[model samples]
Target: MAKPLKCDVCSEPATVHLTQIINNQIHKIDLCESCAEQKGITDPSGYSLADLLVKPESQSAPEVAALSCPECGCTQREFKKTGRLGCGACYETFASVVNPALLNMHKGDSHKGKVPQRALERATFIDRLGTLEDGLKEAISSERYEDAARMRDEIIELKKAMEAAALED
Candidate 1:
């Protein structure tokens, strides 16, 4: 067979898959037959490829105009495109749209606060682990194997704490 078309969003080969891409990011839109089967999503009425590709008229969709602030009704496409907001309230106003877009653009690394406070604590632990890892690298470069080993232990302990806290969260 000829080369398959790559997914426009992920730039990966689009093998029995379908999704929505906006601004060079992908969102799970509709599952193809194969993907739905893989995901164990069986609709009683059954869904066709057309059902996935064609949005129904009854769905109240947001306006796709990039010129206006999706949250605050601010008309500034240039700032939005560049990923900078004009005001503090922009975060609150556009949070719904902004968070997901930011998460997708940043590869699921954006702060989504639905998580518990313990997750924040876990994150701090991860940060501390990172510092320890960095220190270990520096110590090793400076011929301080002893300090490096100490930092390695600290990092291991910190990582275990982070994992435990994450499970609790």
Candidate 2:
């Protein structure tokens, strides 16, 4: 005898299956036809999956045409329409426009990606110290003395913390 696939929402025989990958995690959902219809998943004229994935800034494509990546010659309008960047330089070129959208999509602007348990603390401290150092250098180069001083102090503190952590380990 074959076992029936049940809907996650209502326990009715599942007629549709959906898979979504979010933040490197796979999420699966099963739904009966009726439940799927109620959720508008079955609507032929409704929003497509790509439409759902589009960022809010991408909704107004025409407005973005004026801003284009110098390196790849990729217009913001093209990025909005395709939801993909043309080159690595696109990130730097479009940073101002993309940062807010990225912040809305993720927890923060900085990448706090997964690290192995064995080296987590050291890796984290090193990453933070590196970022602070970079900021310090940029501030100094830009002649922002107050901001440079603050970044320098932060970097020094991070280095001290890293040393303490290493001693404890």
Question: Against the unseen true structure, what C-alpha lDDT does each candidate score?
Answer: 0.55, 0.69
Best by TM-score: 2
Q: Clash pairs of candidate 2?
A: none
Q: Report the C-alpha lDDT of model 2 over 1-169, residue by residue, as the tens digit.
A: 9988776556799988876664586545567899777667867774332232333453455555467788889976577666567998887777766665455345666676886774987788888888888888898899999999998888888888878877887
Query: Candidate 2, 65: how far from true, in Å?
Result: 1.7
Q: Write the per-residue lDDT of candidate 1 for residues 54-123, one digit (tens) a residue.
A: 2232431444333355455663343433435666666665554555444533556345558767756767
TM-score of 1: 0.33
Residue-pair clash count for candidate 2:
0
TM-score per candidate, chains pooled: 0.33, 0.36
